[model samples]
Target: MVVYAISIYCSITNDDSNLLVHEYMPNGSLWDRLHTYKKAEMDWNVQYKIAMGAAKGLEYLHHGCDRPVIHQDVKSSNILLDEEMKPKIAEFGLAKIMQTNKVTNSSHVIAGTYS
Candidate 1:
């Protein structure tokens, strides 16, 4: 499992807030590498590693964990890269923990951006 630096939940002025801290990813997101960053040319091996890491992370979330976590918004931007270009899944704001035995899950409104 990818270890996060720290997570804190606190209340300030009657308002609740949550914070999650992680190591700085110098390489930024995969989206930035592919679309925004100039001179960003990821080799085939690096790309393969990132793909495998992402797959393992998703596997852990879906089948390895006690409760299946569904990442509602999965996009290139959500895949963060460490200094070594290792991929780590981020941005779980739209994530959902489904009941293990539940056959189906439903939502009233759609979440996430279309484009």
Candidate 2:
């Protein structure tokens, strides 16, 4: 099995030239905007679409992929926004793969910080 996965930015390419590189978002994260702005303006329709997009993306990772994906950590700060305000989930360094038969959400693995 593949031991670990790296950040999208650092994943190596040996012979594949079809790698896709997404641009660094310029609008910062949703958390930052929420904290800095007094009255934010996210319309209901826009919010619905964002929620749907996030759900679909997460669903794709967890179910659509050959191996199940567990987003070890998910929070508002992890969600980034582009200039057009599209939410993009980032920081998959701690993400783990779940086998089809093995038990999930249970392990001897330690997460986050040193104790």
Predicted structure with the largest lDDT when compared to the true one: 1
- Please provide, for model 2 over 1-115, each residue's C-alpha lDDT reduced to its tens digit, 9 standing for 90 to 100: 2111222554445675545355576766556756776216677766675566566657767877788887766555666666666767665657888887876666687654221
Give the runs in model 2 whose Cα sits over 4 Å from its true position: 1-22, 101-115
lDDT for 61 in candidate 2 is 70
Candidate 1: tens digits of C-alpha lDDT, residues 11-78: 23435766665556788887888886532578789889888888887877778768888887777888
lDDT for 86 in candidate 2 is 72
Segments in model 1 whose C-alpha atoms lie over 4 Å from true places: 1-17, 105-110
lDDT of 2: 0.61
Report the number of clashing residue pairs per model: 0, 0
lDDT of model 2 at residue 32?
70
**All candidates: TM-score:** 0.73, 0.63
Candidate with the greatest TM-score versus the true structure: 1
Question: Candidate 1, clashing residue pairs?
Answer: none
